[model samples]
Target: MNKREDISGFYERIHYLAPERIGADKPHINVFERASCIGAVPFSRRDYYKVTLILGTGRLDYANQSIYIDRPALVFSNPLIPYNWNPDSSDQHGWFCIFNQAFIQQREGLLNHLPMFQIDADKVFFPDADSVDEIAAFFKAMMRENTESYVHKDDILRNYLHLIIHHALKMQPARDYDRDLNAAARITNLFLALLNRQFPVDSRQHELQLRSAKDFAKQLSLHTNHLNRMVKEFTGKTTTEHIAARILLEAHDLLLHTDWPISEIGYRLGFQYPGYFNSFYKKHAGTTPNEVRKQAV
Candidate 1:
């Protein structure tokens, strides 16, 4: 299987941290730390949502972007995004709290106010020392409440979580980036999001969506050349390249994990002819699907 096709690479090469998960009995807060000597785990991309609070010093390298967060920074990861973190050997200290998107979604009015869910990390906040202490207190209280048996614990926790995130936004400095995304950039971001949603291909024998870049551009109401330029500017990769790479990666996964026949797989992926699919796979993947499957075995 192509390394990139695996869930880990697609999501973590860049990742989204989401709202906390609220449990039925009580909303629980999970806190843990990753020390320098302990090393950082290559966190695989999960199908669920998670919100991370990084208080220690570490390096997060996602795709070509690297951000060094040394102070108390709140990071949110949504299931729709893939990401990974590389910890620094020195000054590693922090806590990670996770919860589900649905848990927070329960509060109707509160959902729209969540800056993390808005779009990119441009809206994320880094609280000052005092602000951090207040946020810590809010979490600590929730953790304490979680330990006891109480009614409406999930509701209370969600509300508190909402307040904490909102307060962090108030205390932190405003972002310098243009929150007003341009038409081309907005279209490109939406296109990328659409591409990611239709992933983890079902079979090596298949051609998903017949995987059309032109169709995607049309859906976004933009010319093919303009769409390609926007994607190139933001991701430094052509639209077709992204689509083809995603297809090839998923093909590798299917070959490794599923028992589907090669011909059936190709057809499922939208290929009219198995031989055409085989040639396409071989050209980009450096080997036929059969070879990849056999190697996996």
Candidate 2:
């Protein structure tokens, strides 16, 4: 798995100070020119959203696909997508906006429903030369507004961001996931993206949020049976089964790799009681968690 990068560390690398309101209730947005960039984007999951206008040529790697872009294009990357950007040219010049989820709230849930923000969505867009100039204008407006102290600057900047998204949507690329089962594929990708968002169990204090198929269904605003049926049709497994397999796989990793107590691991994986986790682990793995740890040691 790729390491996770947050906004603070991202700005630190470029020797710039992040906004004071990051990770807070208030929204935060930053705009930067690629000319000031000093390095390539490593393959990692970012805890923010990034939209870039790539005027310079580059190769992008993500989701097991490698695409080389020799023309001006727009690339949209969300926190769920881990990607590596390799610029083939030394003099890379473009504009990018980085913002957290909170920054784009109150737009009728616009970002979440868009294909460009989806994990499996086609993010690279080849806009015409005129469109590129048009898109560049949005970035220029953002850059100009980002440095100003105007009271409503964020509101205007936020609108500029959406304009870019709307612009790219006019030239949306074709998707090839889920065998072209458009309806099933869209919901499945959204479900899978939501499933992935709750992952890695990074903290003992934060248990799995979507612990069951029903929980996921409620979150996605779909009926439980419908969600399960769609997931099964698309992925060859019921939604609950997929969730269990992922939780079990993470349990295996934690048991083999970490010295955390079984009780703590169980709690982190959403088992309310240690005995419950033991039973589940034994039933799934045909052995206890301790036995797995012992064998690994």
Candidate 3:
């Protein structure tokens, strides 16, 4: 398992000021200034979503996608892709916020549809100089709201986050993205939503309800072959590939974030035996479950 920096580990690595705030029920949105820590941010998968305001020159390594930012840029990072930030100079200055699905009470799946958060969307956007201060102002407001005594601080923080997202969206003109979904595309979306509903698997007892393409197709009231064909035609990946990828992601998170045994983890993920789980983990993740668990230890 590749090491995924959890919210707590991220704070510890970056020497955050208020790491003590992390908890099961209290995992709220957090704001932070750029730390003077030497070297780059760890190049690994993350368990949460992050948005950063890169105020200076730097290079962002997002998996194989390398983006060099020389201006004030806004970058969106989600859990799927592994990323690392290397400042061009020690004069790094910026603001960033870390949040996750739990923070979005009503819009749990909003991040998936956002342009910036998409895997292929331009990850780095240069805000116009005129709008630079305006973008910074939103972050500053978030910082102020993070420490305020207001009862609706989370709401304020969430709104500020939305402002920054909208600002970035405004910076990038409408591409060929907006269109009415075809039947295949709509089915693909529904299939994806149904698959996502089983994810972020946290408990040993909480086994996945939908495990394979056939299961998903049945749930969606479509023939398995039809579902597979449409998903492949629309998304360039078969329905099984999508299900496997999502399950693989959940396996990564569960193996790292929890202390459950490998056997139990396998059980909850629809693998009845540890051997089956280990083989599947290696086949999809290119690493053994034990290897992944070692990083956490």
lDDT of each candidate versus the true structure: 0.59, 0.79, 0.76
Query: What TM-score goes with each of the models?
Result: 0.51, 0.67, 0.66
The pairs that clash in candidate 2 are none
Top model number, lDDT: 2
lDDT of 2 by residue, 103-141 (tens): 766454556666678544578999999899989999999
Superposed Cα deviation of residue 55, candidate 1 (Å): 2.2
Determine which window of 10 residues in candidate 2 has minimal summed lDDT. Answer: 172-181
User: Candidate 2 at residue 184, lDDT?
Assistant: 71
Our tally of clashes for model 1 stands at 28
Better of 1 and 2 by lDDT: 2
What TM value does model 3 have? Answer: 0.66
Model 3 spans > 4 angstroms off? 17-21, 24-27, 36-38, 106-109, 175-190, 193-215, 224-297
Rank candidates, TM-score, best first.
2, 3, 1
Model 3 Cα displacement at 146 (Å)? 1.3
**Which ten-residue region of model 3 has the weakest summed lDDT?**
173-182
TM-score of 2: 0.67
